[model samples]
Target: MTYSLLNLAFLVPAAVLALVATLRVPHRRRFLRGLGLTLLVVLVLTAIFDNVMIGIGLVAYEREHLSGVFIGIAPIEDFSYAVFAAVVLPSLWSLLRPSRRRPRAHA
Candidate 1:
């Protein structure tokens, strides 16, 4: 299989878990859209900065095995960092917010 496709093995599962974790919190839809859009912006900014740094040889990918898709000189793995950031930030944000409603009385 191609290197790009090989990455799906990790990215897809991590994304699925992220989605599931995000959805498990109540009021998810109310916040998820805004959170996702915010993450998109952060992702783009970080990707550009990271790729440029890699291109300039400031830091390097230690892993020899990498998906060869390059944004300039950075590997696709760089973008995956954004995905994790998107998932994790939102999950933590939800965890921090206090619940708005108390549980209903048990019958």
Candidate 2:
């Protein structure tokens, strides 16, 4: 399978997991804002580091596996890992943590 299709295999599930976590997570607006910021930083770092690696020949793509899309010689497929990390980590935390809602008191 091509790299893009391979990435879709994992990304789709992670996206679903993130959506479910969002529902469980309180403070919806805050969570979304944090998620956005995390994604921005992770993607930016990936772009910079990936380009450096590809440029220095420390990394290489088969070209046939790639979709021919690139950011500074780093294949677009390389960025999927960054996206996955950014989405999945916070989501898993939200899912695993106990709910803050307290039990109701009986009068």
What is residue 98's positional error in candidate 2, in angstroms? 1.8
Instruction: Judging by TM-score against the true structure, name the best candidate.
Output: 2
Cα displacement (angstroms), candidate 2, residue 9, comes to: 1.1
Poorest 10 consecutive residues by lDDT, candidate 2:
21-30
Runs in model 2 with CA error above 4 Å?
102-107
Point to the candidate with the largest lDDT: 2
lDDT per model, in order? 0.72, 0.93
User: Over the stretch 1-107, how does candidate 2's per-residue lDDT look in tens digits?
Assistant: 79999999999999998999889787888888999999999999999999999899998888888999888889999999999999999999888988888999999
Instruction: State model 1's lDDT.
Output: 0.72
Report the Cα lDDT for residue 43, model 2.
99
Tens digit of per-residue lDDT, candidate 1, span 11-73: 687667667757777767766786788788977887789977987889886555676677777
